[model samples]
Target: MNEPQAIAGVPLRWVGPLRIGGNVATAEVEVPLATYETPLWPSVGRGAKISMLVERGIVATLVDERMTRSVLVTAGDAQTAYLAALEVDARLDELREVVRACGRFTELIGFRHEVTGNLLFLRFEFSTGDASGHNMATLAADALLTRILETIPGISYGSISGNYCTDKKATAINGILGRGKNVVTEILVPREVVRDVLHTSARAIAELNVRKNLIGTLLAGGIRSANAHYANMLLGFYLATGQDAANIIEGSQGVTVAEDRDGDLYFSCTLPNLIVGTVGNGKGLDFVEENLRRLGCREAREPGENARRLAVVAAATVLCGELSLLAAQTNPGELMRAHVQLERKNATTKLGG
Candidate 1:
């Protein structure tokens, strides 16, 4: 497949190209950085400018990685639930062994139990190698459940997924326990860069974040999240990279924080439920494979490392888009004008062709 051309007047650069995660033998992957111009009035084009800064190493991003999955098991009665909990704790070592035996890279991290009168729900968390671990977690949960039933008795099979895993929905659980790759992407934009490039001050941006993202979201009844349009960039990137786009529902649940550090802007996006993986379903398509290969996620020493790298890149891209859109909002009429101009240009070009 051909390499991606420039978009939104921003040049594309391959950033990082660095060796990430465990093991030194894995191939070094570079994330593709492109300029993105927001559709807003006044048209600041902060997206493209932020891309340039990321490519030039002016902004630093750190990735906290994990490949997690949760499974739910229900018990018939409270007494049964209590007994099952005791057995589960007693066989923790054996359960880990069962998980290891089931897959080379699957590890049982931890488990939680909740009881509502007679019903008991157990959520098992796992670290599946290189994969998003949805399927892996389910399979491991099945085996473990079977073992528990045989040993404990009086407990019936609840479901492969009890919704306690909280797959595609926005909930407080995923934010607290964390699903997929929990990534926090931040950039420290210089005071001069903020004014000249972003066309706004750090204080303006921070105050807007407080008023719009935090307070506005609270007033609007946002559930455990305060961010503007995280799904925009995430959906585009996920589609290009072969991720399950529906995961964007929970993936969009994140917080955008802007701080005025002296005169500079410290902007970050914390995405807790970014369910992404390098190798899994939908990743085998030719275009998807090409994208992963280009992004340096196709090769890694371990199973989960590549997925972690992909998560970091995805988070960083979201941050760039968020910064651009927020900056555009700082100027009156800029957002709507840019949209009209860009959309009209596209329509005109199409009609001309």
Candidate 2:
């Protein structure tokens, strides 16, 4: 409802204390959503134009009334940090599968990592160039930590445990194990139907792909998800489970777009930076638990339910984004403006009421 107040630079929120390789540090930071919009960009092909249409559309619809807090995770050694990265990577894989299954897609590039032992605290980052994979990354991180505790012997099964921990939608928790300081992951989508105009109408293009039966055909044959979808889905999942949402922007990266000689579309997504945990600040809400239930992770149980659910959600998001983009690529401005106007009308109705 209210415009976000702008500062010269994005401010970082203090998530909590993290231990990295024998050194304990506090993690603090938040990435600003890039709002740069330019009109002079060229379109995907000749006789077209691209702008901030897609970015605007998705952000407008998905990020309503939600905000993410900062996070910090500490690990005892580099091995722990590396393990954390592996955990994030595992989650990203789940997301990618979902995206591809939703349509025909692949991961052209992907990455995962973590930062530990900073006086400034744990630094977390993630991004998904495809649709949105916040949930995938977050849930993965939580599951990984919890799994470690379960598998490891005499490892305190508590705060540092990545168990099913969801605070309010606005809080964060620090999962500490063997002094793990910070953890992060990132992924991106490289394959898009309309590359040039992705920034403008990404969601539209994905939707179009489905509407035009482009994705349906791909799905019928068989579909695979991309790393980018996984990255974004993980981030979104985390945000929903009381993790920071904005961190997802950097945690996910490396998106690629592919098309055959006939212009048949294929895409790939990847994310290597995911820093999230499930044992610190925001695991104390009733509604948050209900939301997790919707995702199928009622508690930290055997088989890592939270992590698995995150993977499925990532796949769903990728499918949705792919379909959305396909439809937009075919219809262009028509679909793009439809939702924009709908949003405006809703605002007007609310104002008038």
Candidate 3:
């Protein structure tokens, strides 16, 4: 056999043992993040620290889970494409049967389509248990496409990926229809906790979210997203957890919502594309397996329970880091100063200074 493959050693840390209450998982869990941005460990740590002081901690709700792939087919004309779409729509049960034969874990959930001239883009969505579902979705779509080409009249094959599935790209459709784990996490911080821990008032953070994340992103022409550094936390977490790190592209396209509830703070992060899983491509490595086990993502469970739990905790982690960053930005120079100090300290300590 050949020599063992060498893996890139990104700095990894377990930031939160943040308490999460949801249907998927109800317990305290530490989140692992592997990133070069050293400041994230402490930043998310602060948010996780704040979580424990509150009664409910963080509430993470699992909204939905799906993986999608689109197939491009050609017809004689737009009218032919439209008619072909109806035929395929009417054959949903038959298509599902074809998907069932392809893989046991893959279930054809539903699909949406677009007809452009003689081109038809059929986006097939699937439920792939415990997997990020990239390969599985493609597999199911392949089978479905074959069946379609053989059965549907006047429809010829074009491409498997029609860009409608919107994989790893920033798209409005993913936000509107959703891909991967759709999760929303919320935490209510008391006035004292907000002031003492976050070093900013409830009102300040809320206003900053609207002015910076919302209005700012809009002015910058963002596509269906508004948040500061979601990619930071997501990339870190993805790396540590052995996820398809590129998923962070569409995964980070999420929104942050903050509201001032009188003197208290209500902060939330809605991550509709938090594409993560306890199984599949990256889960086999030794370090990744250990991390998943610690996060309670490796437990014996039902069909999709493990993946669901992973997604819930992932969303909660996003809220922690997002809340902390927004809180820091509410004050001048806090963000930059922390980064400078933490990076310098880490570098010095590493060099044995």
Candidate 4:
């Protein structure tokens, strides 16, 4: 057993419970330590989870490493935070639609509100079970910010652009694209569904397929390289909208798993870092309207956040379909054999076997 190693260097720490792959790993570390110098107001006794990825022999690989960034927002009291949280929730609803179109609709968890100066930083958690939901979530966050700005006259807003969005287009926008805090969107899906049909190598899962053909000339790397395939969600989304294609990087990641349940098989896809806004950017692109229509959503009036929700759903839909195809391929004969056996047994029993 690998004993718990100290988490490098950190002073303030929080010890609590964590669930990994349903396995309880009780370890003590820091409780929302100051990754940045900004003031924080996280609650006590709330649920939290820490995820790490390993490749080759290295124990801690960030897939992509990111430094801490901070922003300032202010909310007068808990009621203000709660109200901002509701606006954030409505924006997330838009994100859900996007992922749903691409994969199966599961559930979403995580919601927080932070205050900096006079600005209010709203955050939420989204789960894109099968498909990548990065672009979907990022856009949703942006839309939420826009909504807040429209409603609240006195409050200004900014975002913490570290792991989520730091690309050229994102830079053009104000602050960053995430929820202006240490935001994380974790995905969970069953693994039994996507084993033999698709490549499971770690390198392959990270590649972004959607951007390979469109960005500049054909790039040397393929979508299956190091969390690159996540770009597909962004590519499809950007083409539909007029978004700066670069911001997609701030909110993109992909993960896959295979599971065996008794005699059955299942598969899952997890996408985190979906950064988006509700009312601002990318609501008027011609193709965006078309894509929204395909997903049974209206493109008119504040479609930014709605677009984000739909994008996540679409990614989930894609994932679910991919898993279905793989599952069918692995067990081609089982469906037929099971039916035939059942019929024969019924016939024999009818004759008083």
Candidate 5:
């Protein structure tokens, strides 16, 4: 085994454990937020007039989602693929109950199948409560595969991940079917707030989004998203909270919208594939657990609720940072000027030390 490399740690900045509510019976909750140390974030916060709300069942759908692993059998040809597909279809009710027995709050959402040459590809989707459902979906897939092998004649193992389920990497399927929390964050900045705080106008911000995020992204062949630098905020938040930072790949896929409604600027961000969880994997670490506790995520009424709460707050933070950056870009040299100023201050502090 190769030895681990020693590296200096990056600075971490905690922003808000700000209180926000959802459109549900659950009480308002606090979500602690942080960013990997960056001079830019403080500028973003100065003009943000943000609001957040969580939608429950939609986020819960992340847990209830399913994954299917298909196999090829010696006795199976294209005809066998058809027959096996029918057999699996006929036993949908039985298969769902089988999956439910594997875990609490598990539900089979649906399944699909295809035949390429003689290979049979079957995919299943489920809802796993409170968890991101990666391992849980795998376990259910394994058990479901066993049932297929036992019941369907001549069927042998193929691969557990058919890539039909589509994890990690960005794809159209997750955007359409909906994955993780569907958090929508909105901000309304009065024209005065825009000019005074952000140093730009509502019309300018709205036009910039259309030109840069929408038309510009299209010209560049961007995939199912239209936003600038969502990954910047999300990566920082994930690292500080002990989340699987890699999920930032899908997590960063989102859209930013701005309208010069009347005179005030209206801005919003919709993140559909934010795969995050609070009670598993990295949560046991000292700092991660402490952060969760401070955010009020560790004390939710149920296992999955805390994760949902975290997701909304996360979406809100993304909006705050995005709005600030776009506003800064409206002026010719504002972006680089801010960077130079912040970095110079940082260097001076280090020299004094």
Candidate 6:
């Protein structure tokens, strides 16, 4: 065995002149994805082409955004814990001041708590600008914990992260309360487009989505998710753009809604936990920084704006791939055939590209 230092390279390709229309951004932009699934490029490209043909091409709306960190403390008993929780709730203004003292781009958005026996879990949420709020929320939580211990008596510190923050885990709380950028991407495909581009009817895709995505997932005990391979697209985009790729664990917890509107097809993906940022630890690499810059996430803008745009684009990318995959599955053998075809090329090729 030999210890060596080198950067790992994955096959990268820019897919989609994806047309996006929404509050955050409106443009036809090229998206870069790095993955071994070569079929994904064309799959997403098919959806992107449909986007351009449609009217409201991938209407990506950024609904809500926040980063959370929870701290655990102990009290004498449940009664003592209840009183202390209320007391802390009353002095939220004071806690905000504590956060302001240390954080410039992070804003305290208040908190929620869960008390069990003598243990108290205080989950603090914040609006972290531009950068993902993992480190930033932890830093502010550290300051808040000190003030809390000093002000409120009989409450002792347990751990800074009580797992209530639920970072990178596929918990239902993050799906409901949201841990990162919450983006919903949708596109309306005309009957002709569905027939021409997808070679399937809106009825077929919508029925397949219900039977396979919803019921099949429920049968398999999937939590807060109803989609095909959201992780595949998230990983490709995250790896290409320098995100904490593990966040996809929770980020993949999303829903795919499909409906046949008379004859047209309305498809949407609601991703509540899209944990990505333009400026972060992994973003400093030469290729990563360049990719971010090219993706228009590196521009000078208002705090949190760049990250929001990035999140919107990322959500739209997921939609493109998800829509394509689901549509392909409407017809039997298309999905596996395409995957085998592409993977065979990747295997035979010299570089696994």
Using TM-score, give the best candidate's number: 3
TM-score, each model? 0.85, 0.34, 0.98, 0.32, 0.84, 0.97
lDDT (tens digit, per residue) of candidate 4 on 1-353: 57447432222222122222211111222222211211111111121221111011101111111111222345666566556656656666564454345334322344455554445554444543322344445544454455556765444554533222333332312233232111212223223222232323212222222232223122653232223234544444443433445545543434344444442333344443334332234545444445445433453533233434433442332233233323333444743554466566656876999
Residue pairs with backbone atoms closer than 3 Å in model 1 (clashes): 40-334, 40-335, 40-338, 41-333, 41-334, 41-335, 42-334, 130-303, 130-304
- Give the poorly placed runs of model 4, Cα more than 4 Å off: 1-69, 72-228, 276-279, 299-305, 317-353
Model 5 stretches with alpha carbons more than 4 Å out: 1-8, 17-21, 24-37, 47-79, 351-353
Residue pairs with backbone overlap in model 3: none
Name the TM-score of candidate 4: 0.32
- Report the lDDT of model 1 for residue 346: 60
Clashes of each: 9, 123, 0, 88, 11, 0
Residue 37 of model 5: what lDDT? Answer: 44
> How many clashing pairs does model 5 include?
11
lDDT of each: 0.71, 0.32, 0.91, 0.35, 0.70, 0.92
For candidate 5, lDDT tens digit of each residue in 186-205? 66667777787788899999
- Writing each residue's lDDT as its tens digit, candidate 6 over 102-186 gives 7788889969999999999999999989998899999999999999999998899999999998998878899989999999998
Q: What is the lDDT of residue 160 in candidate 4?
A: 36
Alpha carbon deviation, residue 162, candidate 4 (Å): 8.9
Model 4 local distance difference test score: 0.35
lDDT digits (tens) for residues 100-145 of candidate 1: 8889878988887776666667778888777777788888888887
Models, CA RMSD each: 5.7, 18.3, 1.2, 22.2, 4.4, 2.3
